[model samples]
Target: MNWKIWKKKNDHKKKKTKTREWVDAIVFAVVAATIIRVFFIEAYTIPSGSMEKSLLIGDFLFVSKVNYGARIPMTPLAFPFAHHTMPLTGTKAYWDGIQWKYHRLPGLSEIKRNDVVVFNLPVGDTVALENQEPSYYNLIRQSDWKTVNSQYTITSRPVDKRENIIKRCIGIPGDVVSMKSGIMSINGKIDPLKNTGQMPYKIKLTTGNVNFEVFSNLGFKVSEMQQLDGETYLANATSEMIQKLKPLDFVKSVELYVESPSTNDGDLFPLDPKRKWNVDNFGPVKIPAKGWTVKIDSNTMPLYYRAIRTYEGNKVEQKAGAWYINDKVATNYTFKMNYYWMMGDNRHNSTDSRYWGFVPEDHVVGKALFIWMSFDSEGSFLHKIRWGRLFRGIH
Candidate 1:
């Protein structure tokens, strides 16, 4: 009825509308950014030396999500009570059509060798990390880190007790990788291990027990060892030893050895075992393939239960001790996840695929596109920046 009052009311309505528009804009931006992260690129940081030379410690990288084709949102599961269900009718049978189908992504090709990749650790979870199998503890403890920097403080995340390592791919599925000295090989082809001579010395194994080495490379040592039968096989050895040993012989069982790793402060990582040599000393072994399923027996069972089946699916037979697919016993899937054998260019000092077996297929998350940024998890963020590695491409 009153013109002045009508005009005031209209102005109030316009203010409310503007507020809603701003809220909508903010929400839209957040959702759009999340979508891009889920289906496109993801950022990751390198925290360990396992992938040294290729990816330095503290180097941050952008991982391409679409490279391997994104796994369709199987219910788009998220943290906490979020899960897929019948949304409209309030039903729970939301995703019953094949339990989330996996498309091979026809347009996207499979992984190739020498491609730097990010993958989950071979273990599904760190469940096995609890057990202190001498070898298991050695592998974890020997990594160049500590639970606490000095005392009382948690140096890094406990769940990340094991390193989320970055390494260069040295082998792929169906490829026979061989290494000698610092050299590497695939399918009988050799990748010469360069003697960078930059490694340190720390411990040696005169007996089965780990002890400090008196000197450098001169001492007979087997660093980072695994038990084979009664004797201690070198965790690292030279290729000459692999070539010298007969099939299934002691030499075949023996691993490589180095002088030690305590040149500066051995506590940084595990002291070098008496065995300085590594895969280089051993004959080239064929990393198992996907179709080549094997019976879950004593020999193949450990690898099957752990490395193979941990990430993907496989049929297991009990007692008969055979595990395989399509009823084909005694072999493993050769190329389930496009295997990668990673190694640090610093051969003598690096622990890589030569110690651990082949990396699986599904475990691969993405390729390291470039180093966008870096920070020392233990040091001041600005001071610890590795400037030279910034903007560097991963080979």
Candidate 2:
């Protein structure tokens, strides 16, 4: 071979080798990241103020997938780092051509009540909008059903591919959950987390100007307060904060502000006017446990209908007012999976299980471990870092 030709060939081989090395490194990095995310832990940032004092907006957390068992990927074929949508392009990151059944590896502990948990949104399986802004469930109810149905495209998502939501798990499997005038009761007992959760309170001022300064001074969100009347203001506050307000000289009364249950809000689960359950006054309904069976009838079917058909993967219908499951005329439903009730710490502002129904076991992602880093977007550079919130353990 000519000397020049041989020298050119050697140069090309070196360039090819370098390209192969770079490709190998890229592949390794992607694989390692995906493994870490799926099995050990993954990072999540608080996008909204739903968790407020417990978890602030801009707080970045390291969620532990192993705490309640790492869920095996149901929709495994996807872009490595993205959750559901491909960043920038706004397209689906996953391909659902091949899907797997729900499975989880044994974990450190079971999900207990009041544990701040991260799970896939229950009503997120079907979305009418691309971004799914306020939440599909709320959007549909708030808008004219026929208008929305005709105007927007509806997309379906698999269990794992749905949007992720973080909230405090208030009810576990088989536990009866109810909210009496903004107070959560589990299995006939008031939730012990009264001091931690936030709810709207009517603060009636007896005398003097509204001391709005006191709210900010006490670390309460001033934006959450709304002036209802001259002396009366509605504020979303924690039980501890309500105690502080009650003792104030200018404050005449501090009472929990509950919406009238008689007013049929179609936004609530079941969407049946007869249920008469509102956000502040909700269920005594039981969370379904694995293998738990319930006798279904016209009265009970409305509550568990979504769970039976959507979550548990059963075809259910009513013929001549008699319920049928999986084409069989059945009066009883044996739950195939466990279910949980999740609610935001900031109750009035959150769209959670109260609006949608129970969260199925298959949708459980992981338990929120702690804040690794926190940023305050509303603050200046020097004050941006929430130093106190950094590395704080999540309850």
Candidate 3:
């Protein structure tokens, strides 16, 4: 046996040490790939026509991950259980906060207004407090099975998810938004929509709720009324937006606010706040103050941040829940982060803040700088090329 082993060792030496080089190559490849995925580029595909014209169905693009800070997992504090560990073992350790590396955004400046960006979905997030004597199984059982028609109806999206969506940002923090005749306004200013070689037509400026459709991601329907231009914004215009744009005596008409809302000019208002009106209306309210103080009584809390904070995020502990703000916890609420309002350029088609309100600070993804490629799939893959939009920077 010893003679055989010696012979095998001598044979291996003669064969050369190519195995070590192969191992090193693999390690280097993995490290390089991880860096690219984490800090540089991310590939995403359009999920639907909701963002039609700008980002079409089947369109694919590379979104730069480092446009915002990269969330690295192997930071110094990531030691101990740096990789994996025995599940449920009390001996295991992990970092609850970002350790070693200082938390900071490394790429571009602050997220700007009118930048088509992506972020985490702020739909249903909540926390709960259990009773001292509560049984563990009961809590689990309650979560598993619940009343059928409750307001917090938990539903699931289909397994195949859309990779990414591209839309133009119209509003930002502290913008007073309202719509008239389907026109969009930010901070009392309406977007000055010029015919950037897009189809141009004369739009009527009527008062009150007039139903029209522009491109939008969310399918929004209704709204209330406020005055502008000469038209009254039909806040609840969903049921009222005439499915057909029949030049009716009663139905008001809206203009094309953006051939493309991604332009720098879109950031500026279309008309003076004192002049125009439209329902695809928006803004007149300030974005929620990040780190600002406030009271959370049952009353005011429901307006400003209530629908988004407690309503959208965790436990609605109706426990005479008089929450405190900052160092002052009473019946008041305070903001721990800033809030932003976003809308799609396709006003009539998009269901954004009007139905699903407020995008939080942490959810900011990246400023859409350019469209490396764009595709529109009317039928099959071979015919999906949208050649006109390729290599175009996000206006």
Highest lDDT: give the candidate number: 2
- Full-model lDDT for every candidate: 0.49, 0.82, 0.46
Clashing residue pairs in candidate 2 are none
Residue 220 accuracy (lDDT) in model 1: 27
TM-score, predicted candidate 3 vs. hidden true structure: 0.54
Lowest-scoring 10 consecutive residues by lDDT in candidate 3?
Answer: 155-164
Among these predictions, the greatest TM-score belongs to 2
Off by over 4 Å in 2: 1-18, 127-155, 208-211
Per-model root-mean-square deviation over C-alphas: 13.9, 5.2, 12.8
- lDDT, candidate 2, 191-239, per-residue tens: 8554667788888898647668887786677876788988888887888
Query: How far off is residue 249 in model 3, in Å?
Result: 21
Across residues 72-126, which tens digit of lDDT does each residue of candidate 3 receive? 4333332221222334663324443442422344765556666667654443222
* TM-score against native, each model: 0.55, 0.87, 0.54
Query: Which residue window of length 10 is worst by lDDT in model 2?
Result: 141-150
Clashes in candidate 3: how many? 62
Instruction: Return whichever of 1 and 2 wins on TM-score.
Output: 2
For all candidates, what are the clash counts?
A: 61, 0, 62
